[model samples]
Target chain A: MSKAAIIPTQLSIRVPVLNWAVWPHDASVPEGPAHGFELQYIDAMTRRRLSNLTRMALHVAGVCVGKTPRVRTVFASRHGELHRTVDMLTSLAHAEPLSPTAFGLSVHNASAGIFSIARRDRSSATALAAGEDTFGYALLEAHVQLRSDPAAPVLVVYADEPLPQVYAARSCAGDRPHALAVLLSHEAVRDLTLTANRSTEAPSGGMQSLAFLPWLAQGESGSWTGHRHTWRWH
Target chain B: MSELKLQIKQLIVDALNLEDLRPEDIGDDQALFDDGLGLDSIDALELGVALRKKYLLKLDAGDASVRAAFRCVNTLAELVHARRTDSERTANE
Candidate 1:
């Protein structure tokens, strides 16, 4: 008898909450001379270490207290640590030598490191830096990892900082760096179904490309284009 | 020195993005690491970077003296003053 290929089923998410920190209609970078998102607005958002998105994680983590502390965490950022990287490079150019602090924080995964340390979570944490398609890619990773162990929940966090002047010149799409994180787990009530299909190009308009909160807030669903990737939610 | 100390305190607040802190809140000699400001290793690193950028001073890994300089904002300003004079001496020589 021929062996049949196993097609994994996606686990359902219960009590899913999406949080965002968006800076719209305000200039995050004023004469910053770079394309990357500036850290100027970080303080504007909140004064806490976790920021807005991580605060959401804290709540989501609470919902799954005992179930958490072991679930894998996936973080996606399109332009991770751009400001710190810019500062480090400029210091190096002058032979000033990068500060150990700046260099450490400049890593793409630094936020995840902070999140892990704060939570005292020793679970697996994955940091991804895929420009444009970061959101869709993160969701896909979460779905795949969720299928690996149906019993465990997966926390997926997506964050972006605004472009600094140098990076802005090259890849400034909009005026905000928004973040959203979802805790995916198996629940009896299935809230949503996600399927993937082939697409030749990204859609240019719609709410799908925006953060999940806005989509939920506006009561809109469907395909949307963000950066270089297309996302569809029905 | 006191004036310089005040400036350094403000710098610390700004660099760390300490929203609720005020210049009067931080005592000059209190430990900036754990008890006082609740700063961690990352804060120390960021402070070092900010200090170097503002004062144009390079930290030497071999020297225990560097720790004394980073002990507090006052100490940092004193170190900057001394370095400035030392550089002047070298140029004159």
Candidate 2:
């Protein structure tokens, strides 16, 4: 007997809290770059060790889960520290040794690893990168974790930085550095239903997480349609 | 403060990214590890690399003197001064 695959028709989640940080691309500021990241939540020495992408992720994650540890975490990024990887490659090409600190913190899951260390959290953490649908997959992973333990909340952080100039030709929607954190639980404050389907339409530009930011910021029920799926929050 | 001590202090601050700290703020004999400047192992490794690059000194990770030399800014300055003198003396020979 052949077994058929089962696809979930809908998924529900309750977001107890959410936080986001987005860099300003326009030349509104007179002097320094406008990253829009205060990051007062982290200490000075710890902050020094973080990259821009990790800093954004940790900032939002700290805000969403204040003084709360021992919760499962899912971090998603499309291009995780591409600039750092490029720098390492350039150094190799020149026969220069790589910086130990940079090499240690340049992985795709470095943000999640640093978050765990900073918070002293021992709970399970997962890092994901799935093309443009990374944010959706991360949320689904968080949902699975929430289902496993109803009492514990799962923190999902999505952060991405713009691709290096070498790969600028393939940039997508909202490619600027940004981070979003959502605290999900089984207790339903709001219901998010995700439906997957096939479509040939073009995907949204920049990071997929950007599309859900507006709906979350407004705190109103809405729907966002992606290239191959639709997310409804009500 | 001695010039070498001041230089080592500045190197520590810069290499470790010790924000809100200046060279003058660090005491010459103050402890740099836990209970003082609160630096950890990673900072130790980074400072060791910086010292090697700046002073052209060799550092042995397994050597006991390395930890003693890192005890304070005074000890670090003394280590750097000794290494420089040794290199100069060897060159003269």
Candidate with the greatest lDDT versus the true structure: 2
Residue by residue across A57-121, what tens digits does model 2's lDDT show? 87778777766657789998988888889988986897655666778889988988877877778
Best by DockQ: 1
DockQ (CA atoms), all models? 0.39, 0.36
Q: What is the lDDT of candidate 1?
A: 0.58
Worst lDDT run of 10 residues, candidate 2 chain A, spans A18-27
Q: Write one digit per residue (lDDT tens) for candidate 1, span A136-211.
A: 6777787778777777777777666557787656654453545455667675223444443344475553233254
Q: What is the TM-score of chain A in candidate 2?
A: 0.81
Runs in model 1 with CA error above 4 Å? Answer: A1-70, A172-175, A201-215, A225-230, B33-45, B72-77, B85-93
lDDT of 1 at A57: 33
Which stretches of candidate 2 lie above 4 Å from their native place? A1-45, A67-70, A117-120, A219-234, B1-4, B63-67, B81-93
Residues B22-92, candidate 2: write the lDDT tens digits. Answer: 99999998999999989888888888877876777777888899779999999998888777544543675
